[model samples]
Target: MKGRLFAPRLVLLHLVFLAAVVASGWLGWWQWERAHEAGGSFQNLGYALQWPLFGGFALFLWYQVVRMVNGTELHRQGESITVPSATGHSESAGEDATERTTGGARRRSPVPPPAPPVTEEEDPELAEYNRYLAELNAAARSR
Candidate 1:
């Protein structure tokens, strides 16, 4: 525990946590002073109360980080989580489309393939545009 706490990265984190707490406390103090001034409003007082809570929250987050680094954080067990696949099948099912292996990698999503390109014969507007372009080309060649 002590070793983890004194690690270089953790030491940096501890300094950051201290800075955050001290800054928050200083901000709270500034807000409190502003709240007591002649031009002060209730908003300043609200902020004065809120800044200390922010400092406390920072302390809580720092503690959680330390706990996580130390691997002492509690984790829930005996819970089976079911993830849904792109093909509308849950992982709990016997067959998952996402789990279908292709050279050890998962298969792609089951989206339909793109439609083939439309031919001018299949589209009257496209055929009309092509006829107009042909006429313009022939006129240009004559000129």
Candidate 2:
């Protein structure tokens, strides 16, 4: 029974799949015949046969795509979630871990507070230079 999904497109898909298979099989046969007649290297024979196998693979892929579009095939689908870090777990798992460690306390950022800015006065020469610069800036602004 034809479903509403891709009913029109199936004809085109079938044509393309048929073309691919036919071409691949022809190539494989040509390669095999060439190898048999002129003492061609085994490589040609291998490649020739590989063409037909490639065609078959194309057909297989098309079938898979159709099945997937119809919601019939489910393979290799995985569950992945965006995470801030490379801890190999999801946010819920991280929450559980935090609760385990903190005895069910609400989760909070573990980052430390920013350090206090260093004072130029620590170096007398630097402090003097900074004062001079500040005076220059003040004069410039006044002008």
lDDT of 2 by residue, 35-138 (tens): 88877889988898799889989889888867766543121121222344444554632332232223443333466333334367567776677778779999
Q: Which residue pairs clash in candidate 1?
A: none
Clashes of each: 0, 0
Poorest lDDT segment (10 consecutive residues) of candidate 1: 72-81
lDDT of each: 0.74, 0.65
Segments in model 1 whose C-alpha atoms lie over 4 Å from true places? 72-143
Which model scores highest in TM-score?
1
Top lDDT prediction, candidate number = 1
